[model samples]
Target: MCAVEDHPHGTEEWWDRLGAVLFGPWAPQAQPGSGHVHCEPDWSWTLVLSDYDLWCVLGGIGRARLNGQDFTVTSGCVLMLRPGDEIEVRHDPANPLTVGYQHYTHGAEHRSATVADTCPPHFLPPRHVRLDDLSEVRRHLDGLARLRRRPGPDTRARVTAALAVLLLEIHAQAARGTGALPPLMDRRIHDVVEWLARHPTLRLGLHDAAASADLSADQFSRLFRRETGQSLREYQVAVRIRRACELLAESRMTVRQVAAALGYSDHHLFTRQFKDRTGTPPGAWRRSV
Candidate 1:
């Protein structure tokens, strides 16, 4: 029941009130830092990420509490406090607590002072989870904060692009947290991951991957899933899709050639799978990129 009041003041001060004001010591001075905040919320926030709120903690550490979950945070720990999940705070007065945060909408046209926004009032992620060592994530929030305040031709597009990176980070982390890849994961699985990524055309099955780790097929399947948090089938599909994107965007390959490179014999099936996962057909997606 010990909750911190929402301190919007530090964020404003941290980001120079999102205006032409000179940067404070806490914020970046020259690089025109990503449109993010370097805030010391002296009080703990009862709310974390709303359906419209996305946050990242860059420095300091604390414990975030949801209804049935808790997180030990450090510089790179990202929190997913889906709608309605309350992340209460308890900080040491002697040490102080500071967090890097950015709040924006996900195509949800809602505004402050109204809960009747278009998006769900409270949307929880598949689970309340913590992703670690996400170095690429913090900058997007900075970009979000920066673009939201500027006016130009591509402000909306810029903001949308930044938001995609942030959300993708969250979803990827959440997927990894699914007991398939515990925070303290095994080393062998890391090797398998490297192999799988490097040999996207190998078309691995449970036994084939397990053999790389000296494990039997059944043993490999269980341990691999337990260690990576994804079934062999699921993991391979993801790898294929990722490689497909790369070949499509960066190479002179047709969808059929790309599919063949990823071990998909049927280009039509590959197209269907790619569309299902990315919401865009392979050819169209490549063109846009």
Candidate 2:
């Protein structure tokens, strides 16, 4: 069964003020393959990050049930699961399981569970990031573990800062959404995708998206979904919506300006699409959040 403990420090309130709090950084976590399964609602959250859990698998593999769906996770896979999500990891005897995890809260307030802590209302982090290369993650975790164990007047503060940096790094990678896997892309397409992410407002014709992959429109469409779990149009919309949310929540920009900044062509399209994803009109969503 997963362990539950009290907050490590005096007050979790500081997390809200600072946009992040990291606790329980456990690395090189392994479980004996005894075929034991833990089943419980077993969800946890604090007012700080609003109940989300971030965990990583560093080695081995195991069968897991997240909100009732069974799947497998292997080394270098990271998950930011919902606060109320029910999960169970079935210890596999053959390979065992090695895991690393930390609980954290992000965002200025509990308006949402978005990674940047910028989304209003509420949002969950991506399903997972399958890291073919784990060097960066390894460094962060190793440093966090080492820094946290030393005793000093500044030890806790230093650990907290390191944790914040680590969380941001993970979020940056998670920002890729369906396009997180760099190794899976052809060089030309990878460069194009990188450019697109940097300029979310850039409008591209269907042919342009296809040409980036050096494939026919149909082939590109199929491959994009297969690799990213979203269609071309849906992915583009996601990028724009994220930018819109950031501008609205963090800037003095008006709704119209936000829409324009995102290259929406018009507010009507932006409002409709924003509402479709966020379940509220842009103005209303901004106000409520």
Q: Which is the leading candidate under TM-score?
A: 1
Per-residue lDDT over 1-289 for candidate 2, one digit per residue giving the tens place of the 0 to 100 score: 0111111221234334324333222111111111112222332212322354556777666767666566777777776654456766655565665665665444433234445333322223354555544557767877866665576898655755676666545644554333332334545556656777898988777788888768899887777777778887888898889888888899999999999888877789999999999999989989987
Residue 50 deviation, candidate 2, in Å? 8.5
Q: What's the CA error at residue 272 for candidate 2, in Å?
A: 55
CA lDDT of each prediction against the hidden true structure: 0.59, 0.60
Best by lDDT: 2
Candidate 1 has an lDDT of 0.59
Which residue runs does candidate 2 get wrong by more than 4 Å?
1-50, 107-124, 180-289
Judged by lDDT against the true structure, how good is candidate 2? 0.60
Deviation in angstroms for 35 in model 1?
6.3
Off by over 4 Å in 1: 1-42, 47-51, 68-71, 108-127, 179-289
**Cα RMSDs, all models:** 12.8, 15.2
TM-scores for every candidate against the unseen true structure: 0.42, 0.41
